[model samples]
Target: MIGRLNHVAIAVGDIAKASAVYRDTLGAEVSAPVAQTEHGVTTVFITLPNTKIELLEPLGADSPIAKFLERNADGGIHHVCYEVDDILAARDKLIADGARVLGGGEPKIGAHGKPVLFLHPKDFCGTLVELEQA
Candidate 1:
């Protein structure tokens, strides 16, 4: 089952600049940048009063974020991640209830260092959904 709403990811061209802007301009406290080499990106997390904001920048040319940014210059909301109690169960339930998964059928480690899986946008009312277990 789903728990709470986790961080909402925003794909950016530059993580440091975005983190600086959020910290200095908006007075948001940013967390230390972390590298997710498996996913091919570096991220800086800015914790908010409610939910967290993740500033994601591509680490290399073959990174997915690179294609995302290339597809849209303005950059858009990448995905919405939700905290789940059981990722496999949640995934099964969602699929049983008619949801399409984007990546692996099993959960994989995400940017937050938790098991995560993405439901396809087509199955999520045109918005990509990420289910993660804390």
Candidate 2:
């Protein structure tokens, strides 16, 4: 089952510019960009009181974020991540309930360096849902 909200991810053409908007204009605490090669994204996290906002820039032409940006030129909300105490169990339950899991239903190391899984958007109110191990 899902736990608390982990972070909301935003797809951006440029992570630097997005970080500045949060850091300079919004006066938020943003972290330095860190490349997640496996995930094919460069991330910048804006820490908040209850959760975090993740800014994602495509790492390469083949990156998924690149495709997302192609469809959404100006970029927008990418996905929402929720923490889970037992990711594997949650995956199994979601599967049994006929929910589709992305990436062949396997857990991948996320931006937070935690095991994570992405569920199909259609199954969750047209919003991509990411489950992260707590």
Taking all chains together, each candidate's TM-score versus the true structure is 0.92, 0.96
Candidate 1 minimal-lDDT segment of 10 residues: 72-81
Where's the lowest-lDDT run of ten residues in candidate 2? 60-69
Model 1 residue runs over 4 Å out of place are none
Model 2 lDDT per residue over 1-134, tens place: 67899999999998899999999999999999998888789999999999999999999667888888999999999999999999999999999999999999989887787999999999999999999999
For each candidate, the alpha-carbon lDDT, in order, equals 0.84, 0.93
* Clash totals in order: 0, 0
Write candidate 1's Cα lDDT for 35-130 as tens digits: 888889898888999989888888976888798898866666788888988888888898899878776578888876789999898877888788
59 Cα displacement, candidate 1 (Å):
0.9
Error at 107, model 2, angstroms:
1.1
